[model samples]
Target: MPHTKTSDGVRIAYQVRGDGPPLVLLAGQANDHHWWDDVRDDFSDVRSTVTIDYRGTGESDKPHLPYSVERFADDVVAVLDELAVHRADVYGTSMGGRVAQCLAARHTQRVRALVLGCTSPGGQHGIERSGEVRRSLIQSDPEEARQALLKLMYTPAWLAMHPGPYHTLGDRSMPAHARRGHLVASNGHDAWDALPGIVAPTLVLHGTDDLLNPVANAPLMAARIPGARLQLIQGARHAYFEECRDLASPLVLDFLDQKAPLR
Candidate 1:
């Protein structure tokens, strides 16, 4: 429940747990710290993970403005500074992965390694959701919004088996006043221009069936970043971590454990 004050004095909330090499987890867009709870136990054996709620989500302060990925990246920098963690492995999912890539590319000293989950290189992927899906997400009802998001993000079987997490995920949909901003920032995000600059060891995890952010993004990211490795989770979708934590967690841990060639 600890919080850090960003350069602009916004209160950014975060939590640190477990013990090992430090791993910072950036949750997906609209998601909060709890997004990692189901996977943390799997990581505890190999990492000390820190999870945070971005400015407009979870327990963090939801300011009306300054919620772009750049600001969110700065918020992340502030959190690391507050924790006295000069360098740590950084993992991000969805929008969080974009923020993580931004941090590694812009603030190289702060990120030791990078893991991007179910995200994209942004503008390159030809995959675009239909207007109906976008309309359902922007609708008034949180439950409907949540369902629509899950439909795009998770496979049908995964949605059926984990009804509880999907319900909890509903709470993260766009808030009424910030709905427009959220859409603009997310849909407008294009990290392809920046991916080539990330020098940290990189691993891109994508789902073969990811609709919201297509799996095609993985190859684009891996090819651009020197020595980056791309892994595709078959039968998984955009919300693969939430749907297949058991399979995904171990792959992530193993990737982070890989030793970079000696300089």
Candidate 2:
């Protein structure tokens, strides 16, 4: 466990695993470095996976203030700087994808390649979730909410075997103010203008049935990032990266190993 101070003086916690070409793993909303727990070892054979706890989550400083995707990216950069990793392949999911967008676009030189999983560009351009899905997220019953989230994030077959829905959802113990700030940061993300500016060789991944961020946003983001490739994981949902790690892990490795063309 290690911590680094961001340009704004916030402490970000990070962990590194394996040893090879560096691969930065950015977590989704309200998630921490543990977001990669299920899959970090999968990538250990060929890549050094670096994960961080975004501000207001995990062991990082919890600031009761507004948060932004850009600030989150800066926090990532700060950790990387502390580790002396100037540039690395980046993978981010959901809100992490939005943060990756800001990172690659605003700090283009620090990202060697980019992977966006089940994420959106935000603003009016990103496809909105269905009414039923949105309503399910706010359900008062914990079990009901858990069931709804399981359905939204994992295919029924996968959930049948993996009954632990609580673990699927990342840490939920952050303070109410931090949680609120996370909501504001993720919902307020507007990367439509920044997408085209990402020069890294990009890979846009999504589940064919992802209702949380919607599958349509995958191609939309791919088309915007220059020379970006799109891969849809069949029969997976919002958490395809976790549910189908067998498929995604290799795809990411192949992408990072290739000579990505930015045309």
Candidate 3:
């Protein structure tokens, strides 16, 4: 139950788990550290882990103000600094991935490796779904939202085949403050040109059927980072970790394990 103060004085809560080299987990939009409940223990074999609740999410302090990607990146740095960790293998999903990308670009020394999951390069906007559809989606129930979100992240057949697990995602909810921050952060996200500047050893993962942020985003990211490798999990969705933990965990653990020597 430890917390760190960001430069702006917001308290960011984080938890250290397992035992090995350090691996920091950055959750997706509106998601708290609990989102990692399923996969957190899976990586224990390879590294010690730190799961963080971003400034506006989870147990972290949330203030009314404009949320920027830069601020989120700073929050990550502040946590690492408070923990006395000079370097760590960073794992970010969706909005969290955007923060990790910014961290690698601005604070190269602090990040030893990176795992960017179901993310996109900012310049290229995703999803031109009907405005009526989009409006309806915002007002939609969590279950409907979850179904739509899962569909956007994975293919149709995959969702049809895996109702139990996908339904579990809809049941998980975020705090009100986190929901607000997610709207602000997501609205502000756009990083098309900055990808080339990220220097950390990076892994870009996406699902071919991801409708929210398509698989094309993966290559777009890979093409920019010097030697970053791309892994497209077939039939998976944006919540790839939840949908395909067996496949995703090993890939992430392998990447983190390989970076232990450098860290």
Q: By lDDT, who's the top model here?
A: 2
What is the C-alpha local distance difference test score of each model?
0.78, 0.88, 0.76
Clash count list over all predictions: 0, 0, 6
- With candidate 2 superimposed using the best TM-score fit, by how many Å does residue 179's alpha carbon deviate from the native? 0.6
Local error of candidate 2 at residue 207 (angstroms): 0.5
User: Which of the two candidates, 2 or 3, achieves a greater lDDT against the reference?
Assistant: 2
Runs in model 1 lying further than 4 Å from the true structure: 124-127, 130-132, 135-142, 167-175, 260-263
- Colliding residue pairs in candidate 2: none
- Positional deviation of residue 243's Cα in model 2 after best superposition, in angstroms: 1.1
Candidate 3 lDDT tens digits, 96-172: 78888888888989989999988876654433334654664575486686556655655666567766443223213
Error of 2 at 206 (Å): 0.5
lDDT of 2 by residue, 1-263 (tens): 68998877788889988888788988889888877788888887777888999899899999876799989998889888998888888999999999999999999999999999999999999999989999998889987987788788888888889876344475787888888888899999999998888999899999999998899999999998889999999888988888999899888888888954322
TM-score per candidate, chains pooled: 0.89, 0.96, 0.87
Ranked by lDDT from best down, the candidates are 2, 1, 3
Candidate 3 lDDT trough over 10 residues, lowest sum = 164-173
For model 3 the TM-score comes to: 0.87
Q: What is the lDDT for 237 in model 3?
A: 64
Q: What value does the lDDT take at residue 41 in candidate 2?
A: 87
